[model samples]
Target: MTTAIYWFRNDLRLKDNPSLMQACMAADQLLPVYVHLPNLEQETPWGFQRMGQHRKIFLDQSLQELRSELRDFGSDLVEVPGDVLDVFEKLRAQIDADVIYCEQIQAPEELEQVALLRNAGFKINPVWQSSMLDSQSLPFQMQEMPDVFTQFRQQIEKNKFRFAYPVDHLKSIPPLPAIDISSTQSLGRNTISTGGKFQGGEQSAHTHIQQYFERRLPDTYKQTRNQLIGMDYSSKFSPWLAQGCCSARTIAKQLSEYEICCGENEGTYWLWFELLWRDYFRFLHFKYGKKLYSPKGLSKHLGNEFDSEHFFKWSSGNTGESLIDAGMRELKKTGYLSNRMRQIVASYWIYDMKGDWQAGAAWFESQLIDYDVYSNQGNWLYIAGKGTDPRGGRPFNVAKQTLDHDPDEVYRKMWLT
Candidate 1:
C-alpha cells in the first residue's frame, strides 16, 4: 500500500482542511506529524523570547486538541523538536514514505523550508487552504490585488463572489504507521496558564461561531468590535483563525447562513470585509516575499529608529500611560487584546517612543498568542504607515483614549493600578 506523510504546520484542523484532504486522497496510508522548530526560541532581533508565554500556552492547547481530533480518525499526531529539516530527514528515514504533504506557507523561512524539502527528492504537495475565498475565485489575480481593502471589497461585490463549502465528515482509517521515536517534550516560554483557559480546535471554533450567529453578534459587531472589554464584544475567532484551528472559508459560509436568517448590515459585512483584509495580507506575503520583513517593509524609505530601552518599557506595560499601560499589561498577562487597545498601544510605541515600527511588530510577535503573520505584520506596518496605509504615523492621544475607552477608569485601574 502507498504510504505518505502529512506535515502539520500552522494549519491544524481537519475540518475544511484542503491540505489534509488532498493528502488523504493521494495516499493509501498517511502519517500525520507536527514538527516544532527549536530555533524560534532564540532571541529575536529585539531582545525578547521569539515565542512568548501566552502564545506558547495557546499553541500547546491547539496541538493537544488536534491530537484528540486526529485520534478519532484512527491516526495520531507525532511531534518532533529541533530544526525542521533535521526532523523531517529523520521522519523520512523512519516512515520510508512515498510522499509528503503540507499546507503552503507564505513567510520567508517557511517557503525556504518547502524548497529545501523539495530538493531532497521528497514529493511535496503544498495546498492552499487558509482563506475565506478560494484562490481560483478571487476577483483579481493574487499578484494584481488592489492596494486598499475597500477597492478589493467593492470588486468582490461587483463580481458576486461566494465562499467555498466546508469539508464533509472525515472517514476513519487504521492507526497511522508508527516508527521508533522518543516522547515529545514541552518548549519553554516565560509565562504559564494557571487557572486560565481558552477553548481550542474545530469543535470549539464551530461552537463559538454558532453562539455568535445565534445571538446575532455579527449584526452588532461594527459597533462593539471596538469595545475594550468582555468576550462577547467580538467574535473571539482570532485565536482559532490565526493558528488555522478554523478555516476562514468555513466561518464565511456560516456567516452567509446568518445573514440569510437575520439579515445583513454594515456590521455583518465588516466581518467579511476584515476577512478580505486578512486575505489581502496573505496575498501581500505571496507578492512581496521577504519584503514584509525589510526595514522599509512594503513602503518606500519609511521607518523609525528609537531607543531599545523605551521599547522594553512599552512592551512590559510600564509606559506610565494608564490606558496604554492597561492594554500592554493585559497583553502581557493575557495573549489577547482588544483591537482598539492594540491600535492604542501600537500608536504609543510608534509615535510616543519614536521607535522603529518593526521593533513593535517583533514585540507583538513575541507576546501575542494569536499572532498571525499576516495580521500581526500587516497591522504593525499599517499603524507605522509602512504598508498599505497612505497616512503614516497615527499618534494616539493617550489621555483622550483613556477618557474615551476607559472613562470610569475601571479598565485602566484594573490593569494599571
Candidate 2:
C-alpha cells in the first residue's frame, strides 16, 4: 500500500486545503505532522527570543485543536519538536513513506526547507493556497506581476479577477498508516486561547468570521478600521489568517455573500481592497525573493546602524514618547497591534529613532502573535523607504498622531498610566 506524509506548516486547517487533499488522494495511508522547529527558540541578532510567549502559547492551542479535529476524522496529528528536516527524516524511515505533501510557503526560509527535503531525495509537493486569489487566475504571470500595489489591484479589477471559491469540506480523510515512532509527541495542550479577544483554532476562526459578518461588521469597517482601541473597530481577521486556521478564500467568499446580501458599499469595497493588498505582498516574493529580506531592498541606498541601547528602550516602550511607548507596550503585552499603530511605531523606529529597519522588523517578528513573514517584511521595507514604493519612508509625527487618534488620552491612559 502507498504511504505518504502530510506536513502542516502555517496552513493549519483542513478546510480549503488542496495540499492535504492531494496527500489523501496520493496515499493509501497517511501520517499528518506539525513540527515545532528548533529555530523558534534561537535568539536573533537583535538579542531576543525569536518566538515570544504569546505566539508560542497560541500555536500550542492551534496544534491542540488540530489534533482534536484529526482524531474526529479517524486520523491523528503528530506534534514533535526538532529541525523540520530531522523530524521528517525520522518519520519517513519509520513509516517508509513514499512522498510528502504540504502547503507552499514562498518566503526564503520556508523555501529552503523544501529544497533541503528534495535534496534528501524525498518526493515533496508544496502546493500554494495561502493567498486570497490564485496565482493561476491572475491576469499576469506571477514573475511578470506589477511592482506597485495600485497597479496590481487595477489589473485584477480591470480583468474582473476575484478570489477563487473555497473548496467543499472533506467528508472523510484517509486512515493513518500504522506506525510507531519515538519522535512523535502531542501538543502542549495549552489552555490559554489566542492573545487578547481572540481564540486559536479552526472552530474559533470560523466562529469569529461568522459573527463578524452576521453583525454586518463590514458596513462600518472602512470608517472604524483605523481606530486605536476596541475589538469592533476592525475585522480582527489577521490573527486567524496568520495562523492559517482559516483560508483567505473562505473569508473572501463570506465577504462576497455579505456584499450580495447587503449590497456593495465603500466599506465592503475597502475590505476587499485590504485582502487584495495582502495578496500583493505575497505576490511580491515571486517578483523579488531574497532581495526583499535585504537591508537596502531594491535600492542603492544603505541601511541604518543598529543601536542596542535605543532599540531596547524603543521595543520595551521606555522611549518616553507617550504615543510610541504606548503602542509598543500594547504590542509586547498583547502580541497584536492595529495597522495604524504598526505604521506609526515602525516609522518612528526608522525615521525618528534612526534605528535599523531590519532590527525593528526582527523585534516585530519576535513579538506579534499574528505575524506573517510576507506582510511583516513588506510593511517594514515600505516604512523604511527600502522597497518599491515611489514615495520614500513614512515618518509619523507623534504629537499629531496623538492629537488625532488619542486626543482624549483615553488610549494613552489605559496603556501608559
* Model 1 misplaced regions, further than 4 Å: 185-191, 194-197
Best candidate according to TM-score = 2
**What tens digits encode model 1's per-residue C-alpha lDDT throughout 1-417?**
788989998898888887888888878878888888876789987777888777877777778788889887878878888887787888778778848899988889889988888888788999887777777777777788887767877888898876667777567644477674347543434256711535656677778778888888898898888888888788888888988898898899889988898898998888988888788788778667788888898777868786878987888888777787888888888878888999999988888878888888888888887799878888888888877666764678988887788888888778876
lDDT of 2 by residue, 1-417 (tens): 988899999988989999998888888888998888889899999889999878887777777788889889998888788987898898887788849999999999999999999998899989999999988888999899988789988999999877988887887788888776445775564545444577788998999999999999999999999999989999999988998999999999999999899999989999999999899999999989999998788778878999999999999999999999999999988888999999999999888899999999999988888889999999998888888787877788988998989999899898997
In candidate 1, the residue pairs with backbone N, CA or C atoms under 3 Å apart (3 or more residues apart, or in different chains) clash, namely none
C-alpha lDDT of all candidate models, in order: 0.81, 0.89
Model 2 deviation from the true structure expressed as Cα RMSD, one decimal place: 1.3
TM-score of each: 0.95, 0.98
Enumerate residue pairs that collide in model 2: none
lDDT of 1: 0.81
